[model samples]
Target: MITWMQRHKKWLVITIWISTIAFVGAGFVGWGSYDYGKSSGAVAVVGDRKISVEEYQREYSSLYGQYARAYGNQFNQEMAKKIGLPEAAVNLAIQKNLILSYADDLGLTVTDEDIAKELVKMPAFIKDGKFDKELYIRVLTQNGTTAVAYEKSLKRDLLLQKVESLFDINPSSNEVNNLSKLLFAQDDLSIQILDPKSIKIDYDDTILRDYWNINKIKYMSTNSYELAISKLPFVTVSPTEDELKEHYSKFKTDYKKEDGKIKSFEEAKDDMIKVLSIKATKKDALKKYLALKKDEMKFDATTVIFEDKLPFSAENINEIKTATVGDVLKPFEGTDGFSIVKLIKKIDPKPLAFAMAKDMVKADYLDIKRSEKINNIAKEAMKDFKGEHLGFVSRTSIDKIKGLNPNEAYGFLNKLFMSKEKEGRIDLGEKVVLYKINSSKLGTDTTTQEKSVKDILLRLQKEELMTSLIKNLENRYEVTSSLDNKE
Candidate 1:
């Protein structure tokens, strides 16, 4: 039931930015570019560990890449600057080195054997069912990294893992039971579902006018674009057996069948060939794009479009919208083939007038009035208590409520259990749950896996331990950061 390693939950302030690492090679970018000098290159120092400019750049890039993937074309260098990604990156670097410093003090070390084992398991490095040194070299070289620097980074990561494992506690049977009982406690209850529709609204025109006046900017016309579009004809090319095999070796994980088994070379060959073709054809696409950029090649078509009705995918459209007028976006994936786009014009959004946004304002106003009425009605009902009796329900009683869906039932139950008050109302979006607890008792469900409960308890313990340990480590480690130093 414990599906993942506890050591994987490494976070100082719950790191939302995790590197989308495909290959160890991807992780090693920029280690080859910088000099690990005595002073100039270092951004921050955590005891003996100097966070170099190259290291800071890699961390910053990793964080940036995550945001780019999440927000698509909305993320840019300017946005990154505004979000203070550099500071976040430095903080993350400091936390990592802080943990590493503690690990060193505790005499923890990641051996050559440890790093070798990790490398063999990675899908990128493995070729022909083993760690291929030549393939590793090629991948690393392609990614602009060297083995020495990469291994050092690996060593640090492994060392962190080793340090994390020290706090991995196995909860005792009694401990698991105690925690499970606390988490899944049942409650005797009187329930009242407060649907907003039950409360009749006056639906005044004055309320609409007030709401429209206050929130007029909420209703705005979307930013439109006038774009010059050109589609690059789909390039289909046959891949050599060697090229297919090489691609397969690099990305074999994606070639898995429905049964979770890796497909054979013969079985996955076509898809592998297509992927390689896409990679190869992009080079030609880029060449064509260059000529197109300089206006040597003319556009095939043009369109003036709103954001909602984009020609390309939202991700691709995002790229187009962000570019300045006359700036060309390189070949992005399209329905037919790769397409290059130039932003000829950009139209800024304007606030919609009251006449245009009246319907929207009315709907919003009605909802606001309905919520106010629901709260007042729920408060009175809680005092009088003329609601239906829904006997004992635990957090696990996800199917106990008839009107509420599984998620709503679980949320209401969880809220009720966490509450110290006997009578309360929980606002669940469109509906409100008003409940009065008659009695409470610990749940006795042995059908669920006790190992899962143990895992949960242990995870919580580890989280608390890590939080405390890291706080103590702030005093234990002497950290100095000059992240302001030129990168």
Candidate 2:
């Protein structure tokens, strides 16, 4: 059986790459503006919970300093600036606070034992193949982190992990199998060549104006605010030349040392050899598979499928049913990856086999259990709940809620708003979320209403633009980076 990591190796690689880039660029800085001393420094405010400049700066500096030390000369001030380090750092701090706030609200607590257990798992604290308390203290001291602070951080991380786990949606065995089949299934013979030159758009001013008007919401101006806000005075903490020298001497080794522990050649040689062998084996296997596929091409017909119809033919079905080793069918176009299937083995699709789908089934069951648990928690919380009615809250209104998707919350809100006074509960696809509508009101001010609409429109446009850019880049570039194989 493939390990979860192995099964999702490609996704893992992509995730790692993205994470590495983000880590390097933003250095784990959460969402917010970096200009903390400025009036616009505050990224967000949850009620009266204000994230201040000093707090953001301290966190950012600490995180950035750690990153610089970890990456040594590879991490420079210029690079940090380019990545919007100040803003990223502030955001990170804000997000941490927000998560902790939510965790507190949910009554989530971490024990000392949990912190200790998590600390032991950290590779930095390990020495000579075991947890080393002295080494841990020494390292933390070098990094200017106290044991108490580290423990707090560990506890927070653990709590956040738990909170995130609460939101985990495990795909069912049927879902997983269906997804796998869609990913690996072969396709019938087909060719599609789109010619840009063949396509034409009329260069009419009337048409352009019509299109612009239809999407004026897309390209409209926002009501920009003018402010006479005052900034907090900068608190300077300068070190003397002697102090700087002392500081450098004390922590210079920490920065000079490699990010990870260095293993002896003998220790890593076997693993390195194994990795190389696997690569060679995969290369040879792919070559053989491709050759066999070319030789075994038995289809002599072509068929076209529309956007709304199935792409498979009778021959394609038969080929898939009888698929064996080295038998390659036509390339099947998918939403993401193209599939050129070469069946390793064939199994009769029968009643769900326990051995084959046990993990998937377990995941599904766990997801269901988690959802039920959250629902029960929410239900208990709302037992005597009397809340003001949200007339028509959009997805953004419930962004503060944990264990809930914005879209899901939007749908729930819509249902709640539409339902009669007595029908307080609404089904949110997977589980029921109960909401009480306490009051309803319509806006009178056109400017404020227009501003709200414009804000939403701007946010939507930015999201769409970013998504399109990312999609285009992913489609064009062939990114091949494996964390497991990284040197």
The CA lDDT at 359 in model 1 is 88
Task: Show model 2 residue runs off by greater than 4 Å.
Answer: 1-75, 83-85, 127-130, 190-487
Alpha-carbon TM-score of each model against the true structure: 0.62, 0.32
lDDT value for model 2: 0.45
TM-score of 2: 0.32
**What is candidate 2's CA lDDT for residue 428?**
67
Q: Taking the tens digit of each residue's C-alpha lDDT, what string does model 1 give over 134-228? A: 98887665555678867777787778777777776777788778777877788888888888877787857787888888887899988899988
Indicate the residue-level lDDT of 247 in model 2: 46
The local lDDT score (0 to 100) that residue 479 gets in candidate 1 is 88
How much is the lDDT of residue 431 in candidate 2? Answer: 54
